[model samples]
Target chain A: MLIGACLFAAGLYMVLTKSNAIQVLIGIEFIINAGVINLVAFGKYDRYHNSGQIFALFAIVLAAAATAVALAIILNVYRRFKTIDPGKIDELKD
Target chain B: MEQGIFIFLGLTTVASAWFVAASQNLVRSVFMFFVTLFAVAGLYVFALADFVAVTQIVIYVGGVLVLMLFTFMLSSKETLEKLEESRHPVFTLKQFPALLVAAAFLIVLVNAIFKLKPDQLGWILQATNNTFRPQDNTVTNIGTNLMTTFLLPFEAISILLMMALIGAAHLARKERSFD
Candidate 1:
């Protein structure tokens, strides 16, 4: 659990600090991976119910689908702006 | 033996995670991300969640990471070079505060987990009324549950996937001039 928490925190820090859009995506993956670790850790002890495992499965699917959509959006952003820098693409700033 | 395996998985996960963060090359980072995912999937298997472990590998490493790589290839010819340039402004700012906050959070979380009683942890494994019967096969059980109990959500997800496919195609299509 300590390891899980540490991994989650480190991932979150990278997500928050990274300037590259791809790095940000990696950070998101790390965070999700941390959550999966926690789910599996908890599931280890549960004898009768595999709810944690089921939840983890759903999470994995959701993460995959979400990443697919997100990558599409990132591609779109690159097409319009000619660059993938999140900071420079400030066309929608209020 | 189990502890040794756990340590190996843990080291692999942490090292790959660090590589994912530190690598300036986008493609390399993505590859390292794949490594991290694979390691975590190994951990899931060690935890006795065979179904989840398999799903993690299939969905994340096979499906999602490949999609990411495709996007990287399609979106930019400079994907390799751009990573060398620190154009993203987020990293330019001093990150000490962020590091401090993360460290603080880690300390608290570690303390809390250590304080938890062994019995409390054991309770997580206890069978409940809603537990799936051992007689049923896992894949079949999951399939039945999705079709019967979670039918609506499953249908909704299909609709969502369809919409996503349409949206992606629409977005990616080159604009045509009517003139």
Candidate 2:
């Protein structure tokens, strides 16, 4: 649990500090990994319940699909601005 | 022996996670993220959650990370200059407060985890010992569960995947000119 919390903190740091779009996605991945760690940690003792395991499985699939969509959006951003930096592509403001 | 494996897994997970943060190269970061995912998956196996471990590897490592890599390849020309370009604005004194907030959150979390009861840990250990048997840790159980009790959620996931595919295609399609 100590390790899981530390991992989550590090991931949150990356997500907040990174300016590159891809790095942000990596940070999100780290956050998801932290969640996975916690789920597995909970699953460690609860065998018959299997709820944590089931939730982890669903989370993994959801993370994958979310990443796919995010990448597609990133590709679109690249096409429009020729840049992957989130700081640069601010044309969508109201 | 188990302690040693735990330490090794911990080191691998932390190192790859650091690389995911420290590497400037987007592709390298994505690859490191894959390694990080793999290490976490190993930890899941060590925790006796074989089904979760397999799903992590398949969905995260095999599917999502691959999509990220392909997007990186398709979206940019692999060049040093682009990679080196800084995307963040210059930070003023205002950003220090955000860092303070983050540090405070970390401290609180660490404190909470340390306060967990010894009895709780013992109960968790006993529960884990009873649930997982070596012989029954097969894909068949998961498959059966998904088909039977989890059928609705399973179908929903398929529909979600289909929507993602359509949305991605639409987002990446070439713009048409009416001239």
Name the top DockQ candidate.
2
Question: For model 1, how does the per-residue alpha-carbon lDDT over B61-125 read when each residue is reduced to its tens digit?
Answer: 78888788787778656755756665443334466677667678778888887898533654544
Query: In every candidate, how many clashes are there?
Result: 3, 1
Q: For candidate 1 chain B, which ten residues in a row score worst on lDDT?
A: B127-136
Task: Give one digit per residue, the lDDT tens place, for model 2 in A4-38.
Answer: 76677767767776667877887887788788788
Write down the C-alpha DockQ for each prediction: 0.51, 0.58
What digit string (tens of lDDT, one per residue) describes model 2 on residues B1-179?
A: 98899889888888888666656666677777877888888888787788788888888778877777777677646533567664343343544554566568779988987787533677665674656666665456666666777778778887998898888888877775412
The CA lDDT of each predicted structure is 0.71, 0.73
Top candidate by TM-score: 2
Q: Can you give the TM-score per candidate against the true fold?
A: 0.83, 0.85
TM-score per candidate for chain A alone: 0.91, 0.91
Question: Which residue pairs clash in candidate 1?
Answer: A45-B125, A46-B125, A47-B125
Where does candidate 1 stray beyond 4 Å? Answer: A46-49, B85-93, B117-122, B125-137, B144-158, B176-179
**lDDT by residue for model 1 over A1-94, one digit each (tens)?**
6558767877877776666776787788778878878876775544434556656766676677667777777877776777776878889632
Worst 10 residues of 1 chain A by lDDT: A43-52
